[model samples]
Target chain A: MDTFVQQLINGLTIGSIYALIALGYTMVYGILRLINFAHGDIYMVGAYAGLFLATSLGFAANPSAFGFVVTLVGSMAIAAAMGMAIERFAYRPVRKFSKMTTLITAIGMSLLIEYLFVFFFEGKPRSFPQLLPNDNITLFGNATISTSQILIFVVSMVLMVILQYIIYKTKIGKAMRAVSFNLNSAKLMGINTDFVIAFTFALGSALAAAGGVLTAQYNPKIDPLMGIITGLKAFVAAVLGGIGNIPGAVLGGLLIGAAETMVVGYGSYIGIPSTYRDAVAFAILILVLLLRPAGLLGSNVQEKV
Target chain B: MNWVKSIIVGIIAIAILYVLNAAMSATGFFGIGIDDYQSRLLVFIAINVILATSLNLINGFTGQFSIGHAGFMAVGAYASAYFTVTHGKAIETSLSGLGETVASSIVLLLAIGIGALVAAIAGLIVGIPSLRLKGDYLAIVTLGFAEIIRIVILNIDAVGGATGYQVPGYANFLWIGIFAIITVVVIHNIVKSDAGRALISIREDELAAEAMGVNVTRYKVTSFVIGSAFAGVSGVLFAHYNKFLSTNDFQFIKSFEIIIMIVIGGMGSMTGAILGAIIVTLLPEILRLLPAIQIGETTFQFADLRLVIFALILILTMILRPQGILGTTEFTDFFKRFRRADKPTGGLE
Candidate 1:
């Protein structure tokens, strides 16, 4: 029972990260109907931004909870700016082109970001500076949680709550919904669809940035290529939750996180090595795509003939 | 007659390239006259050409967004690497000197065939499930599938596991050149055939093609298998050329690079693929000659900034010319406009 609880804690910790990243994917897909392949790199960029700011601003010179907030907020702001810039420069011009073209451009953008980081920083993984002092607290029996894990869960929840409030209770959120439902109709109704799209990118990127910094706290290792697999898993999570649905992204993230942890903890009895844990997310993606293309919570839409 | 024409076209194309290489790199018919860097670049160009042209079949012609092509390449490279390391050794030793070269060459061809076959099987499995998906969804699935392949390769110890494998070298410019020609010719022939039309129609509109009895699933699978087979052939060439095989070599980035090649060349044009291949292969090497600067005690290398420059070029190119350099047209099509004054508006549509 303790083992189960321990596994659950671990799963939720990572699952929250996946959820945070998936929100970005889901939101972007909601508006543009694009799988922004570069969104994951934005997450990486966010983490790097946080690292740079934390180190350069002397925040990491001494460990304190106040410094952590500064790092987190700084990363989010920088990532949001990056997200908006990407949409304005890379995506807007190709918005009127083929979906295939936009998709390729997204991929190109992903490569560009990844390689640019690699070019400047080299490929070695850097140990992220700790902004907050860490300690472990036992919950009950052997199931204990670290301060970093607690930070991940609590921060992600707060962000999600804030996001929900924004999406549900704000004028811009309503405008976003209108634009997603019908771009031309929204424009005709005098809403700035372009600005709404950019806003969605900003919101999504900020979440991904949060995920990035949060994960860095837990893992403390940052690399340029770190986003590829995590981003992919988040994509799977979004799909699992029923893509384009906000609540669904969170649901998918937690479930995938739980599934992956369980597979790692207990899969050996079934002759599966823990090394194959990386594959679990993709396997789930394939299964979800085949079994429920619209995802668990997604309503099935008829294919246009 | 078409086969004959294709063979002629292949020979002419290879001959032209051979002369060009002779002048550019001195890697003509025989001898080790060419510098190592130039030869490596030339061989890589041939390999990239194979990858891009084959990818165009599924991506450009059939309009299936497959980003897991590196998965098939990994399958081919590993399979052939295993074969050459195990069976090829015996063939190499059974003959003497020049006879050994002849025997190994034949054995290498057989090994490449096996590699292609295995990769084709993998492609069939991937393509079947993936045929139902399209566009962005398809790209993600293919990518997921490729990552799975990489993980599996990493686990299996026989092919060296994560440590990687080193196989004997058997590839030269001539061999890669031959296979590249074959890939281009065979794919070009298929693209021009009646089946090719069915494939293209599916790309244009799957429902309409199915309504017209094009058997969309079958042709999609077929194009995938053929393209995968050639990717395998390129893998075989890559494995033997580099004489080393590692799962790291076939990462998702490789697939993206191949996509960029076709995208830059013009997705739907063969000549564009070739042009794209040459540019992508040579760009890094060409950039390596950039001047290095000294800042106090530090020597900053402008050469190290090539990938950054390369990426900027891709973003800028996409923004400026999203249709690619050729824009779905061909090189010969341009000259043909002048040759025939009466039929001016016609080109490969």
Candidate 2:
């Protein structure tokens, strides 16, 4: 019982990170309908930026609560700018072309970013500086948890709430959503669809950066190539939750994270190695796509002839 | 008349390749059997042709973009490798494996057959779920699926785990050529068939194709499966030829590279696949000879510059000639004569 509860808590913590990154995927996909393969690399850039600020900027080996918050904000700012540039330069012009062409261009951008990082940063993994305390607080009789995990969940929820406020309460948010619903109509309404699209990418990318920082806190390691799988997994989560649905992305991320944890925990009982955890995620992805192509929370927009 | 010209053009191209292959083998340039390198080049070209062409079937012809060709190849590689490693020698021994008996031939056939069979099964499994999704969603799912296959294979201790599995080194130029020929022949035949027309119609417009008595979902699934089956067969050749195969070799990077071939070649053309594959493969080798120069004792080899140059080429190609070198036109189509009416000679002077 304790193990289940513990696993559940850890899964939720990680799932929040997935949810944060997945928000970016779902948002871009909503308006642009392009996967933004570079979104993952953007998250990676966020983590590295956070790492740079924390270490190079004379923050103590162990940071106070204020220091951690500042580093997180700075990293997210850089990531958001990077995301906006990627959309403006690589994606905006190609928007008029075929989806395949845009997709290929996105892939090129992805590879270009990933490889450039490798060349510049030297392809070795670096230990992330520890800012929070290492002590774990015992919750139940046998279940223990860490402050870092709590921080991840708390920060992600706060961000999501803030994002909700922006998306639902702001004029720009409504414009973004309107464009996603129908670009032709939005353009006719003088929405400046391009600016709205770029803004959406920036906002989503900033969220991913926050997720990257929080993840680094938990894992305490960051590498140039760190964003590849996590980015892909988050994309899967977005799709699983329904591509354009906001709440759905969060739900999908949490489900995948919890399911993955359960597979790791339970597979041990059945003598299956926990190393196959990644495979478990994809297997679930396939199942989701096969069972409900519209996604769990997504509505079908019928294909036009 | 068009078919006759296509057949004649095909024969002539094959004849040219055979002569070029023979000459390269005889030259023995760089002291390593030049012919062997050429044969290896041919093998790379052939495997790539199979990959790019099959992927084009889905991506270009059927308008369904799939990025999981490597997953199918992995399935085939492991299957064929398992066959040859487990059963090849044993069967060979039982059927006069120790002697110069013709029974060894039977074992050889079984290995290739078993390899292709296992790959086909994998194709069917992958294709079923593919029926539900469309475009980029399906591409991501397939990419994720391929990555999963790689990771799973890496973890499977029954195979070589991360180290990769080894198969008997029995595959050669002859066997590769034969299979390559068969793949091209079969695909070419299929492309000209009613099924090909149906596939093209889907590419033009999926909804329109569906409304016009074509079963859209069925055709998509069918072509996807068939394409995957060819990917499997190529994997078998790769496994047997390379001897040692690692899970990393079947990564998403490889699938992307194959996609580059399809994109750089004309998407739906067979000759484009062949040309794109050969050009992309040979580009690196050709780049190696680009005369390394030193900038103030900091020597930079052409090999080091290859990736940057290659990326530039890809970008330029995408921008300038998105239809690829041949576009939709086949090599045979170029040679077709166009009648030119005689110009009026200065008012009938």
Candidate 3:
């Protein structure tokens, strides 16, 4: 039972990170109807950005909560700019073409970002500096929660709440929702569709960057190639939750996180190795796709003939 | 008479190519044989041509976006390698008096056939259910299936798991050239067939094609099967060329490289795919020719930056010319145009 609780905690912690990234995926898919394959790389770029800022801004020297907060926001700000730039330069012109074209361009952009990072920083894995001092908080017998895990949850929740406020309460958020419903209708209704789309990219990328920083805080080790699998898993989470649905993304993210943790934790009893964790996500993706193409939360629409 | 003439022409072509291959290998200046790097390069180019053209059938002509070419390649590679590694000696031993070249080439062709068959089965598994999902969903599912195959290979130790397997009876340029020709001929014929017209229609518009009584799902699966079968052939060739097998070689990145070839070459054009295959295979080698430069006493190696340049090219090409180098025009388009000029009603086509 204690082990179960412990695994639950571990799962939710990872799930929260997946949720943050999935939100970005879901939001972009919501607005653009694109997979935005580069979104994961944005998460990676965010972590590196945090690493850079933490080191250069003297946050590494201080290692305080304030330092952590500053690094997170700074990374978010930088990633949001990147997201906008990508939309404007890489995606905007190709908007008139086929979805497959946009998708290939997204893939190309993903490769470009990953390899460019490898070029600039090389492929060396770096140890992220700890901004907040971490310690294990004992909850009960054999059920201890680490401070880093708590930080990840807290930070992600705060960002999510802030995200909710911006989306539900702000004009741009309504505009975004409108644009997602129908682009031309939104334009005819006098909503600035382009701005709304750009804003969606910014918001999604910022969330991903936050997820990146939080993941670094928990794991400490970071690499350029790290985003591919994680981002892909997040994509799986988005699809599982009924893509384009906000709450569904979070639910799917948590479910995947929990399921993956369980598989790793208890799979040994059934002849499943822990190394097969990556495979587990894809298997789930295939199963989910086969069973429910619209996802758990998405409503099934009739295929237009 | 026409059939007889074509068959004779085909036989003569094969003989001429066989003699040329033999000469090139013997001289090493005409510079063939498996021992030399250039010969190896030619073999790899041929292999890519097979992979790209076959992949183009599904992704380009059929218009289904699949990125799991490497998965089928893996199934082909492992099956053929397993067959050859285990039974190659048996065939060679049984045919001890058949001469080394004859027995080995026969064994190699058998392995390729078995590999392609196995890969076709794999394609069937990944395709039939997946074709239900339209467009991008199918793409993602195929990607997932590919990753799953890789992971499964990683666990099962019979095929060497993560460590890899050793393969003997390496295939040569002559066999690869022959098989490459077969793949091109098969794909080109498929594209010109009546069924090929259905595939093009599906790509043009799925709903409209379905409305026209086209069996959308069946044709999608057909192209996938045929495409994967060729990928299998490429895999057997790849396995023999390296004389080794590892699951690492068939990761999703390889699928992307194949896609990039088709993307660069021209998606639907057979000539484009072949040209794309040639350019993609040679691009890195060409870049490797640049000398390491010393800028302010710091050595700059262009080799490390090749993938970065590739990524840049991918992005810039998508932005500037997403249709690719040849667009939809085949090299044969020129001849077709001349023939049309010589006539009138055929010009409508």
Best candidate, lDDT = 1
A131-238: candidate 2 lDDT, tens digit per residue: 776679999789988989989989999999999999999999999889999998999999999899989989999999999889999998788778888888898899
Colliding residue pairs in candidate 1 = none
Cα lDDT of model 3 by residue, A145-203, tens digit: 99999998898889888988988899988888888888999999999788888889999
DockQ value for model 2: 0.48
Predicted model with the maximum DockQ: 3
Compared with the true structure, model 1 gives a TM-score of 0.95
Per-prediction TM-score of chain B? 0.91, 0.86, 0.92
| Clash pairs detected, candidate 3 | B28-B31
Where does model 2 sit among the CAPRI classes? Answer: acceptable
DockQ of 1: 0.70
TM-score of chain A by itself in each prediction = 0.99, 0.97, 0.98
Each model's DockQ score:
0.70, 0.48, 0.73
Considering only N, C-alpha and C atoms within 3 Å, which residue pairs clash in candidate 2? B25-B35
**Candidate 2 interface RMSD, angstroms, 1 decimal:** 2.0
Error of 2 at B174 (Å): 3.0
User: Candidate 3 - CAPRI tier?
Assistant: medium
lDDT string, candidate 1, B27-112, tens digits: 54465466767778888999999999999999989999999889999999999889998888777777546686698798789889
